[model samples]
Target: MNTIEPRSTPQPHLTLAQADHQDTLRNCVRRSLNEYFRNLEGEAPNDLYPMVLAEMEIPLLEKVLEYTRGNQTKAAEMLGLNRGTLRKKLKQYGLL
Candidate 1:
């Protein structure tokens, strides 16, 4: 006959401590952002993503046009696009 010791159950205090720590981190970030913005003394923040995309598209279209030497049909072909579709995108993006 052999006797085995029973394993002890895990405690919940560790899980609660982790949750509290995460809450503290969130509050710290919120407070820091508030303080930083309150001390701002400059121009307003801009939507950088859209602005960058617009700036990039202009040069990209120009380069594609140059590569095709101003030939819309060949440009569309080389770009693997339908000519009319490319024309529409160009017009929509104000590049036409």
Candidate 2:
């Protein structure tokens, strides 16, 4: 079977007025993290790495698999993960 290529990263097509907001992904991440840290109110945060990855990874995998139309190999290549690793994650997420 021919493999479906993953879609290219989305490009913004905003008007001049909309562009002024500067709502890019980097800014969004920065804003979100800043808000998260601010909400902690001086409490020491622990396991942030795993926490962040766990939060992001599921949606990342879901989007990639959806882009690849449920094809494991192409999704793996697109994600820069080995096929087995991708399969494991997919299985873990109940996608497979």
Report the CA-based lDDT of candidate 2 relative to the real structure.
0.84
Q: lDDT per prediction?
A: 0.73, 0.84
The collision pairs in model 1 are: none
TM-score for all predictions?
0.43, 0.66
lDDT of 2 by residue, 42-67 (tens): 99999998887766788889999899
Candidate 1 runs further than 4 Å off? 1-44
Angstrom error at residue 36, model 2: 0.5
lDDT of 1 by residue, 1-96 (tens): 999877987756657546645657455555655665677666565774675566566666778999888899988887788999879868978768
